[model samples]
Target: MKRTEKKRKDIIDAAIDEFREQGFLGARTTSIAQKANVSSRTLYNHFESKEALFEAISEIMLEQNRSMQPVAYDPSRDFVEQLKDALWGYISIITEETAIGLNRMVLSELIRDLDRSRKFFTETETHDYPMTQLIGEAMDAGVIRKADPVFATNQLLALAKNFFFWPEFFLGENPTPEGVMDDCIAMFMAHYKTGS
Candidate 1:
């Protein structure tokens, strides 16, 4: 079982690398098999088809990302501190070259296949379980006011997303700089900050 798990992980990692480099349609199972140092037959035993392997890679990446998120916001922290934590989390994760490449691959896939684009959106959206839960709690406690949690989620997420996601997608050099987080939190809090 341990050996099977290791082989599975090896194949998934190889497939992820291949798909990201070549896009899904362009990626080759033979290349992935060679990269994983596994025979074609062994690879097929692990994954039924190229689509199966790619979906496996996508699900694994999504689940891995979801698993790393925090469970909830610290109720004890001030709203501004919480906002900073959320914003900083987005900045820290998405700024990396690996994350950028993954996003680029998703966008390219979206152009050819709407379903693939939706896959990326679904993975990114509901997958941040911790943050979504916190947004609910904050609304319940009167720390922020919104009729619907989803609306609040959109607003808060939009604050952090537009800043870097735009720059990332366009390869724009300017990023939200180090000092800007504080100002961001300040602006965000001015709009929604409240007491329990």
Candidate 2:
């Protein structure tokens, strides 16, 4: 990489760690500069303010999430298996360290800046996301019971969050075990499967 690009990445990496540890308000630009082994002037050259640096970190986290886009639902495949694959793919990403840190970081920001948090939610959140698209497709094909695709999508995602994301985010727990995913999938299928 070019020198400037490497320095930019270094600043972002250091800023992420510092923000994760100290939060947006508590994190110091000087500390981030020290951790990145760059002067405060260099950090400022890359980021006009701490908020700008935080925004860059948020973009990195969002990009990481976008990278794990689930495979499109296949009509020929078993619907239950497809749901499992999709949920697992998403769960893996949310349980990642960076994702969790970003979640916490966003929550911290939300306390101080509701507008920014709402904007972030609208832009970055996966609530009305790819999984929702898959759910809608499955409904159109009659793979699942007749239902509101939006509600059903949220329900299934809630199950995954209940089993995985919430616990890890709130309790510092490990990733949800495969057995938990299996149980959640089975429960979801029981209710949503076309003939169930």
Candidate 3:
């Protein structure tokens, strides 16, 4: 990697650690620069301010989320299996240590800043969510009942979050509770499956 790019990455990496450890309110730019092994001036050159750096970190985290392998609908596969795969794929991404820390950091800050939270969620809502695509495809192929793909996607995600995400995110639960995925899939299929 080029020196400049490496420095920028280093800054982001260090910022993540700093933000995770001390939070946005408590984290300092000088401490981030020291952790990154870059001068405060260089950090300023890359990021105009601490808020800018925090925004960049949020963007990077969302981009990483968008980069997960897209799960396409498969005609030959059972809808339950396909949905399970899609949900698991998403769960795996959010449960990663860095993702958890970043999410916690972002959530904590957003709770204090309603305007920023609104904008952040608006930005998040604009993404072409992968599960929505999969559900839409399944609907098109008659594998599942026709309905609002986005709503269906949200339903599945809500279920997963209740069973798999919230515990892990708030309590550091790991490996997921047994049968949680199956229960989620069953609840989703009960509502959305063909002929339901």
TM-score of each: 0.80, 0.85, 0.94
The CA lDDT at 162 in model 2 is 88
List per-prediction Cα lDDT, in the order shown: 0.71, 0.81, 0.87
Q: Pairing residues by index, what is the TM-score of model 1?
A: 0.80
* Distance from true location, Cα of 77 in model 2, Å: 1.7
Please name the candidate that would achieve the greatest lDDT relative to the true structure: 3
In candidate 2, which residue ranges exceed 4 Å CA deviation?
125-128, 146-148, 175-177, 190-196
lDDT of 1 by residue, 39-126 (tens): 9999999999998886665665577567656536567888667757766776667666666666666567668888877876776777
Q: RMSD for each model, in Å, please?
A: 3.2, 2.5, 1.5
Off by over 4 Å in 1: 70-75, 119-125, 165-174, 193-196
lDDT of 2 by residue, 1-196 (tens): 9999999999998988898788788999999999999999999999999989988877776777677664566888987788877887788788887788778876777678888778777776453545776777888888777788778877878887987898888888866676888887777778887876
Best by TM-score: 3
lDDT string for model 3 (2-121, tens) is 999999999999998898899889999999999999999999999999999989988987897778766789888887788887788788888888888888888888998999899999
Give residue 100's lDDT in candidate 3 (0 to 100): 86
What TM-score should be assigned to candidate 2? 0.85
